[model samples]
Target: MPVTARHLIIQGRVQGVFYRNWAVALARDLSLSGWVRNRRDASVEMWVEGAAEAIEQFIAQAHEGPPAARVLRVIAQPVETEGFVGFEKRPTA
Candidate 1:
């Protein structure tokens, strides 16, 4: 399977909802490598690198986000893989 990467910026009711933590857990469960963090603009940003199929699934899940997250938009863009290790939750930026 070809390794792929994507950068996602999810907006709308994402902050203070454990979105980053939830994303970290989901990424780990999907066996992905990357990091998720909260943006100062009240959005969640993530870089996910893994199998293409898994990435697709992750994107789908990210669209819905956690129960408290009212995901209004998910902006995804293809990116170069950075050879990340385990999934992690990063401090807000």
Candidate 2:
């Protein structure tokens, strides 16, 4: 079932890393649309909307981000698609 979801990834060593860039690449590859950004609480936040299988792949990749991030947990929730066109880094919001 094509769906939209928001994810909050608690990464132990994600800051100052290339996690965002890696995520952008991955999301683009998966053809998913939405945004990714760094949170003030030192976590990475993502919103994605696309095919179920692609979103699944995104979740799997997010767990092991950039080979430099120590992903501790990935908290996900449902969200509205909002018809995003592409993946990008959102200015901290």
Candidate 3:
């Protein structure tokens, strides 16, 4: 299957809610490769790449993050894929 890559920005009540950890867990489970991190604007950002179906599932789930996350919106943009071995949690940017 071809890889579908995306850059996503999640907004609203995403911080302090273990959003990054949630993302990593799900992405890995979906056999995805990417990195998720927190932004200074109190939002969260991530770049994911994998099977098209996996990407779709990842984005769909991102709209409703961890139990504590109140994801108001998820902005997904198609982007060129990068070299990522596995899902990771990056320091806040």
* Candidates sorted by lDDT, best first: 3, 1, 2
lDDT of 1 by residue, 1-93 (tens): 789999999999999888888999899999999999888898889999999999999999999989998999999999999999999888889
Residue-pair clashes per prediction, in order, are: 0, 0, 0
Over 1-93, each residue of candidate 2 has an lDDT whose tens digit, in order, gives 656656555566776688888988999999998989888888888888888789888898788888778888887777767888999998765
List residue ranges in candidate 1 displaced over 4 A.
none
Using lDDT as the measure, the top candidate is 3
lDDT score for residue 52 of model 2: 79
Off by over 4 Å in 3: none
- Every candidate's lDDT: 0.93, 0.81, 0.95
The worst-scoring run of ten residues by lDDT in candidate 3 lies at 79-88
For all predicted structures, in order, the TM-scores are 0.97, 0.89, 0.97
Evaluation by TM-score, superior candidate among 2 and 3: 3
Per-residue error at 49 for model 1, in Å?
Answer: 0.1
Better of 1 and 3 by lDDT: 3
Model 3's TM-score against the true structure: 0.97
